[model samples]
Target: MTDTLLNEICALETALQQSQVRNDRIRLDGLLHESFEEIGRSGRHYCKATVLQDLSHALKAWHSAASRRMRRESAAAHSPQD
Candidate 1:
Protein backbone atom coordinates (compact mmCIF):
# COMPACT_ATOMS: atom_id res chain seq x y z
CA MET A 1 0.00 0.00 0.00
CA THR A 2 1.04 3.54 -0.62
CA ASP A 3 2.03 5.78 2.29
CA THR A 4 -1.27 7.62 2.10
CA LEU A 5 -3.34 4.42 2.14
CA LEU A 6 -1.23 3.00 4.95
CA ASN A 7 -1.62 6.16 6.99
CA GLU A 8 -5.36 6.14 6.41
CA ILE A 9 -5.58 2.55 7.55
CA CYS A 10 -3.61 3.31 10.69
CA ALA A 11 -5.78 6.32 11.43
CA LEU A 12 -8.90 4.24 10.98
CA GLU A 13 -7.53 1.71 13.46
CA THR A 14 -6.88 4.46 16.00
CA ALA A 15 -10.37 5.85 15.47
CA LEU A 16 -11.88 2.42 15.98
CA GLN A 17 -10.00 2.05 19.27
CA GLN A 18 -11.08 5.49 20.44
CA SER A 19 -14.70 4.77 19.47
CA GLN A 20 -14.71 1.62 21.52
CA VAL A 21 -13.08 3.32 24.51
CA ARG A 22 -15.52 6.22 24.37
CA ASN A 23 -18.48 4.03 23.38
CA ASP A 24 -19.23 6.35 20.50
CA ARG A 25 -21.82 4.38 18.58
CA ILE A 26 -22.00 6.88 15.75
CA ARG A 27 -18.27 6.71 15.13
CA LEU A 28 -18.28 2.94 15.40
CA ASP A 29 -21.10 2.66 12.88
CA GLY A 30 -19.26 4.91 10.50
CA LEU A 31 -16.10 2.84 10.88
CA LEU A 32 -17.78 -0.42 9.97
CA HIS A 33 -19.53 -1.34 6.75
CA GLU A 34 -23.02 -2.85 6.50
CA SER A 35 -21.48 -6.24 5.69
CA PHE A 36 -19.72 -6.48 9.02
CA GLU A 37 -20.31 -9.59 11.10
CA GLU A 38 -18.39 -10.99 14.06
CA ILE A 39 -17.87 -14.65 14.80
CA GLY A 40 -17.62 -15.64 18.44
CA ARG A 41 -15.35 -18.29 19.82
CA SER A 42 -18.34 -20.58 20.42
CA GLY A 43 -19.47 -20.22 16.82
CA ARG A 44 -22.09 -17.63 17.63
CA HIS A 45 -22.72 -14.78 15.18
CA TYR A 46 -23.03 -11.11 16.09
CA CYS A 47 -24.33 -8.29 13.95
CA LYS A 48 -23.58 -4.60 14.28
CA ALA A 49 -26.50 -3.96 16.59
CA THR A 50 -25.51 -6.77 18.90
CA VAL A 51 -21.90 -5.65 18.92
CA LEU A 52 -22.73 -2.04 19.68
CA GLN A 53 -25.07 -2.99 22.50
CA ASP A 54 -22.49 -5.26 24.00
CA LEU A 55 -19.77 -2.64 23.56
CA SER A 56 -21.66 -0.09 25.64
CA HIS A 57 -22.00 -2.47 28.53
CA ALA A 58 -18.39 -3.57 28.24
CA LEU A 59 -17.17 0.01 28.21
CA LYS A 60 -19.13 0.83 31.34
CA ALA A 61 -17.73 -2.19 33.11
CA TRP A 62 -14.22 -1.27 32.07
CA HIS A 63 -14.60 2.27 33.36
CA SER A 64 -15.86 1.02 36.68
CA ALA A 65 -13.00 -1.39 37.01
CA ALA A 66 -10.47 1.25 36.04
CA SER A 67 -11.86 3.69 38.56
CA ARG A 68 -11.59 1.13 41.30
CA ARG A 69 -8.05 0.38 40.32
CA MET A 70 -7.09 4.03 40.31
CA ARG A 71 -8.59 4.60 43.74
CA ARG A 72 -6.67 1.65 45.11
CA GLU A 73 -3.45 2.89 43.59
CA SER A 74 -4.01 6.34 44.97
CA ALA A 75 -4.49 4.97 48.43
CA ALA A 76 -1.34 2.94 48.19
CA ALA A 77 0.59 5.92 46.92
CA HIS A 78 -0.37 8.01 49.94
CA SER A 79 0.13 5.24 52.50
CA PRO A 80 3.18 5.34 54.75
CA GLN A 81 6.03 2.94 54.13
CA ASP A 82 8.09 1.33 56.91
Candidate 2:
Protein backbone atom coordinates (compact mmCIF):
# COMPACT_ATOMS: atom_id res chain seq x y z
CA MET A 1 0.00 0.00 0.00
CA THR A 2 1.14 3.52 -0.70
CA ASP A 3 2.28 5.55 2.28
CA THR A 4 -0.53 8.00 1.58
CA LEU A 5 -3.20 5.29 1.78
CA LEU A 6 -1.64 3.88 4.94
CA ASN A 7 -1.55 7.31 6.51
CA GLU A 8 -5.17 7.94 5.68
CA ILE A 9 -6.15 4.59 7.23
CA CYS A 10 -4.28 5.48 10.39
CA ALA A 11 -5.89 8.90 10.48
CA LEU A 12 -9.33 7.41 10.07
CA GLU A 13 -8.66 4.99 12.90
CA THR A 14 -7.61 7.83 15.14
CA ALA A 15 -10.62 9.85 14.13
CA LEU A 16 -12.91 6.94 14.92
CA GLN A 17 -11.42 6.58 18.37
CA GLN A 18 -11.64 10.30 19.07
CA SER A 19 -15.21 10.48 17.86
CA GLN A 20 -16.21 7.63 20.18
CA VAL A 21 -14.50 9.25 23.13
CA ARG A 22 -16.15 12.62 22.52
CA ASN A 23 -19.43 11.30 21.13
CA ASP A 24 -18.97 13.48 18.09
CA ARG A 25 -21.54 12.01 15.74
CA ILE A 26 -20.87 14.53 13.02
CA ARG A 27 -17.27 13.49 12.72
CA LEU A 28 -18.16 9.83 12.93
CA ASP A 29 -20.73 10.21 10.18
CA GLY A 30 -18.18 11.90 8.01
CA LEU A 31 -15.67 9.10 8.53
CA LEU A 32 -18.08 6.33 7.62
CA HIS A 33 -19.26 5.67 4.11
CA GLU A 34 -22.91 6.13 3.19
CA SER A 35 -23.51 2.37 3.07
CA PHE A 36 -21.57 1.22 6.11
CA GLU A 37 -23.29 -1.26 8.38
CA GLU A 38 -22.39 -3.58 11.21
CA ILE A 39 -23.88 -6.88 12.21
CA GLY A 40 -23.96 -6.76 15.97
CA ARG A 41 -23.08 -9.70 18.19
CA SER A 42 -26.73 -10.30 18.96
CA GLY A 43 -27.46 -10.85 15.30
CA ARG A 44 -28.89 -7.38 15.08
CA HIS A 45 -27.82 -4.98 12.37
CA TYR A 46 -26.82 -1.40 12.95
CA CYS A 47 -26.27 1.21 10.32
CA LYS A 48 -24.30 4.40 10.76
CA ALA A 49 -27.40 6.28 11.76
CA THR A 50 -28.36 3.71 14.37
CA VAL A 51 -24.87 3.65 15.82
CA LEU A 52 -24.79 7.43 16.10
CA GLN A 53 -28.25 7.58 17.66
CA ASP A 54 -27.45 4.98 20.29
CA LEU A 55 -24.11 6.46 21.17
CA SER A 56 -25.61 9.92 21.60
CA HIS A 57 -27.90 8.64 24.33
CA ALA A 58 -25.29 6.31 25.78
CA LEU A 59 -22.65 8.99 26.09
CA LYS A 60 -25.00 11.45 27.77
CA ALA A 61 -26.17 8.85 30.24
CA TRP A 62 -22.61 7.81 31.00
CA HIS A 63 -21.48 11.39 31.61
CA SER A 64 -24.43 12.20 33.80
CA ALA A 65 -23.98 9.07 35.87
CA ALA A 66 -20.27 9.70 36.25
CA SER A 67 -20.89 13.32 37.23
CA ARG A 68 -23.41 12.26 39.87
CA ARG A 69 -20.93 9.81 41.34
CA MET A 70 -18.22 12.41 41.44
CA ARG A 71 -20.54 14.88 43.18
CA ARG A 72 -21.46 12.29 45.76
CA GLU A 73 -17.83 11.50 46.42
CA SER A 74 -16.95 15.16 46.80
CA ALA A 75 -19.81 15.75 49.19
CA ALA A 76 -18.87 12.74 51.25
CA ALA A 77 -15.27 13.86 51.51
CA HIS A 78 -16.41 17.26 52.78
CA SER A 79 -19.00 15.88 55.21
CA PRO A 80 -18.38 16.29 58.95
CA GLN A 81 -19.26 12.65 59.71
CA ASP A 82 -15.81 11.18 59.40
Candidate 3:
Protein backbone atom coordinates (compact mmCIF):
# COMPACT_ATOMS: atom_id res chain seq x y z
CA MET A 1 0.00 0.00 0.00
CA THR A 2 2.85 2.34 0.75
CA ASP A 3 4.39 1.53 -2.60
CA THR A 4 1.08 2.11 -4.31
CA LEU A 5 0.67 5.45 -2.64
CA LEU A 6 4.18 6.44 -3.59
CA ASN A 7 3.56 5.46 -7.19
CA GLU A 8 0.34 7.42 -7.26
CA ILE A 9 2.14 10.47 -5.91
CA CYS A 10 4.79 10.18 -8.59
CA ALA A 11 2.16 9.82 -11.27
CA LEU A 12 0.33 12.90 -9.99
CA GLU A 13 3.57 14.87 -10.03
CA THR A 14 4.21 13.83 -13.62
CA ALA A 15 0.71 14.73 -14.67
CA LEU A 16 1.02 18.09 -12.92
CA GLN A 17 4.26 18.82 -14.73
CA GLN A 18 2.75 17.91 -18.07
CA SER A 19 -0.27 20.06 -17.42
CA GLN A 20 1.97 22.91 -16.44
CA VAL A 21 3.83 22.62 -19.72
CA ARG A 22 0.62 22.78 -21.75
CA ASN A 23 -1.17 25.26 -19.50
CA ASP A 24 -4.10 22.87 -19.33
CA ARG A 25 -6.18 24.11 -16.44
CA ILE A 26 -8.92 21.49 -16.83
CA ARG A 27 -6.51 18.58 -16.94
CA LEU A 28 -4.54 19.94 -14.04
CA ASP A 29 -7.65 20.31 -11.90
CA GLY A 30 -8.75 16.80 -12.75
CA LEU A 31 -5.36 15.41 -11.89
CA LEU A 32 -5.35 17.21 -8.57
CA HIS A 33 -8.80 15.84 -7.75
CA GLU A 34 -7.74 12.32 -8.67
CA SER A 35 -4.65 12.60 -6.55
CA PHE A 36 -6.76 13.56 -3.54
CA GLU A 37 -9.12 10.69 -4.15
CA GLU A 38 -6.28 8.22 -4.42
CA ILE A 39 -4.74 9.50 -1.26
CA GLY A 40 -8.02 9.16 0.57
CA ARG A 41 -8.55 5.60 -0.66
CA SER A 42 -5.03 4.56 0.17
CA GLY A 43 -5.28 6.13 3.61
CA ARG A 44 -7.83 3.48 4.60
CA HIS A 45 -5.18 0.78 4.82
CA TYR A 46 -1.99 2.76 5.19
CA CYS A 47 -0.50 5.35 7.46
CA LYS A 48 -3.26 7.88 7.42
CA ALA A 49 -1.16 10.72 8.79
CA THR A 50 1.71 10.19 6.40
CA VAL A 51 -0.56 9.84 3.41
CA LEU A 52 -2.37 13.03 4.30
CA GLN A 53 0.90 14.80 4.82
CA ASP A 54 2.09 13.76 1.41
CA LEU A 55 -1.13 14.92 -0.16
CA SER A 56 -0.78 18.28 1.55
CA HIS A 57 2.76 18.60 0.34
CA ALA A 58 1.71 17.77 -3.21
CA LEU A 59 -1.02 20.41 -3.06
CA LYS A 60 1.41 22.98 -1.78
CA ALA A 61 3.84 22.26 -4.57
CA TRP A 62 1.11 22.56 -7.17
CA HIS A 63 -0.12 25.83 -5.68
CA SER A 64 3.38 27.21 -5.54
CA ALA A 65 3.95 26.41 -9.19
CA ALA A 66 0.64 27.96 -10.11
CA SER A 67 1.41 31.09 -8.14
CA ARG A 68 4.77 31.42 -9.83
CA ARG A 69 3.22 31.02 -13.26
CA MET A 70 0.63 33.66 -12.50
CA ARG A 71 3.30 36.01 -11.23
CA ARG A 72 5.35 35.57 -14.37
CA GLU A 73 2.36 36.25 -16.58
CA SER A 74 1.43 39.30 -14.59
CA ALA A 75 4.96 40.62 -14.76
CA ALA A 76 5.08 40.07 -18.51
CA ALA A 77 1.81 41.91 -18.98
CA HIS A 78 3.10 44.90 -17.04
CA SER A 79 6.59 45.00 -18.51
CA PRO A 80 7.34 48.14 -20.53
CA GLN A 81 9.86 46.25 -22.67
CA ASP A 82 7.14 44.07 -24.05
Model 1 superposed RMSD (Cα)? 5.2
- Runs in model 3 deviating more than 4 A are 1-46
Weakest ten-residue segment in model 2 by summed lDDT: 17-26
Q: Model 1, 1-82: lDDT tens per residue?
A: 8999999999887876674533877778777778879798999998888877887898789899999999999999999998
Q: How does candidate 1 score on lDDT?
A: 0.83
- Greater lDDT among 2 and 3 belongs to 2
Q: Listing every candidate in turn, what is its Cα RMSD in Å to the true structure after a full C-alpha superposition? A: 5.2, 3.0, 10.5
For model 2, name the residue pairs that clash: none
lDDT rank, highest first? Answer: 2, 1, 3
lDDT of 3 by residue, 1-82 (tens): 6999999989878766663533554454454443344334445542434444655677789899999999999999999992
The window of 10 residues in a row where model 3 has the poorest summed lDDT is: 33-42
User: Which regions in candidate 2 have their CA more than 4 angstroms from the true location?
Assistant: 1-22
Give the TM-score of each candidate.
0.57, 0.68, 0.42
Q: Rate the local accuracy (lDDT) of all candidates.
A: 0.83, 0.83, 0.62
| Top-lDDT candidate index | 2
